[model samples]
Target: MPPRPPQKPNRRMRGFEPASGLLRDRIRTVGEARGFAVSRLLTHWAEVVGEDLAARTRPVKVGYGKGGFGATLTLLTMGASAPMVQMELPKIREKVNACYGYNAISKVLITQTAPMGFAEGQAGFGPAPKAPPKQTDPAIRQRAEETAQVVQDGGLRAALELLAQNVLSRSANRAVTKKG
Candidate 1:
């Protein structure tokens, strides 16, 4: 056998230390999932309200509600003029209801809690939307699986849109990744 040349040290394998390997991997997974969920939610907003409105409203809070069936989103309206939130609350409610395939949403509470320094320039009466109620159903699980597959196969953006619609329709929170 011929003597082999010394291989150059690679950074890819060295960058991630074994001490935090498990934690790092878990964090990565979580980040990706959160990103997907946010994307999906934004798409839903855009479809309901217009691209312009969606762009203006940024999500400020997101979390899985009780029983892990519903996802809540609180968004802050960037720039507005005179009680825009109040005027838009009904439309938002309608859109949310329609998105969930019915009136599955128990509440669409809105509040005025803009970030510090934002309120002075902002012009809205109502608060940001609160979390939707928890939901539990076989249909929601099935949809989560389907949505997860779409995300795994089609990259982040496509999966997000799929997930957003499914979550809205089913009023569910879990994002089930495809097994195998």
Candidate 2:
């Protein structure tokens, strides 16, 4: 065998780390099984299509034509919103294709149903409500504030305090969860 050239010192054998590697990979696999090859289309629906459109429609599945040549995306929407969604099909198709980083979706199909048809649409015809921030333990917040107090820059101190609070809050949550 020929001798190999020197490799980069920063390189490691382990694979690149994703934000939530294990759970994300598992979710992607499950999504693909349901014909959602681009899992981001499911997870980040609101970001891909603007919040307004996303609130009225949800991607149901990605069905490919015979021989897997053309892909059609199906969306679920309330009956009253069907006409609006129909009018926006082109825009939806464009946005969804953008999410795939290619012209992957050839057609967009809208399925209209009652407010709670097939037990779907229970999430309602509106943008998901923003989750309120989790409250940090008083003790944790106080400690973090004290630790960051010595920092000179106001912004840096605030950032450090928030980071410390998050770390402490997560550890505390984990401890409580484990005990329960």
Candidate 3:
């Protein structure tokens, strides 16, 4: 198979596209309509799914697909969970339709994505998995503190101390025990 093209950085839409006279008003109206759909979708999504999931989901791009009978909603999601999408999408679609007066939007398509990973790591993703918390036990903490204190005494001194106390002591202990 052929290699995929390199992904480009996403840029913000500054304002309405340039159009003349009557067309300009139509353009602005369309932009506003789409914006309304996005806003309402976000709100509805938060209510339906959850704020945490909603925050992870965003409308990256929205436009007419193929012949323009349907609206394509490109969502940048952190991960692909089919059941989660199934639960959230219908509500989002209904909200979009309501926002547009239930006229212009024929359908809503959800495309999951990971913009950062796509741009930085060149990977299309749903979402990055949450990392586990670091270890924080007292024993580990004490060991780290002891090492830090020894290093503070100077690298050579620390190294000698470790060698004599750990390596050499273990060897001498073994020898003494074996002899006894």
Candidate 4:
């Protein structure tokens, strides 16, 4: 019997490429259409502007003027914070331009909005879970209650007691698991 010839490698089936690389052109096209070089400015806005400013403001879009001479950046901010952000326009423009490695933004436009206005379509991660209320040993509960007795406010005392009980229970469970 004759031996078979070796098979040629498949040219059409290329192995894994990172999603970022695969979508780079499309993302860049969309960003350019919006007068921005990259989405990194929008995505890492908190890093571009300080957390305090980022929490209060949202970058909406960039508009380029005729001949691409001057570009304006529009930001949406809560009504109460609009004045404050308006005053910081120069600083924000500098920071944003730095992100783009040039003086791309020539002006900052502030649009005041209600608290719920700008956040209308955005989804937020729900509130964190409350610590489990699993009952701990009687001794631990008694100790926590006694320690919280000095708290002047009834609400504060109750909160402290719950926190102490949760901590003690979690530590006890960890110790038991380690031993077993």
Using alpha carbons, what is the TM-score of model 1? Answer: 0.33
User: Each prediction's TM-score against the native?
Assistant: 0.33, 0.56, 0.41, 0.53
Please report, as a residue range, the 10-residue window in candidate 4 with the lowest summed lDDT: 118-127
What is candidate 1's CA lDDT for residue 163?
61
* Poorest lDDT segment (10 consecutive residues) of candidate 3: 118-127
- Give residue 61's error in model 4 in angstroms: 0.9
Model 4 spans > 4 angstroms off = 1-26, 118-180
Residue pairs in collision within model 2: none
lDDT of 1 by residue, 8-66 (tens): 96756746566555465565455346532433344355786666555455434444567
For candidate 1, the per-residue lDDT at 122 reads 51
Ranking the candidates on lDDT from highest down gives 2, 4, 3, 1
Across 99-145, the per-residue lDDT of candidate 2 in tens digits comes to 98888899999888766667633536654489998877799999999
Q: What tens digits encode model 4's per-residue C-alpha lDDT throughout 1-180? A: 899899996767568878887787887787777777758877688899998888878777899888886789988776777888888999999999999889999999987766555354242223446998665799889989998999999999999999998888889899999999
Better of 1 and 2 by TM-score: 2
lDDT accuracy of residue 26 in candidate 4: 83
Q: Between prediction 2 and prediction 4, which has the larger lDDT? A: 2
Candidate 3 structure, TM-score to reference: 0.41
Worst 10 residues of 2 by lDDT: 119-128
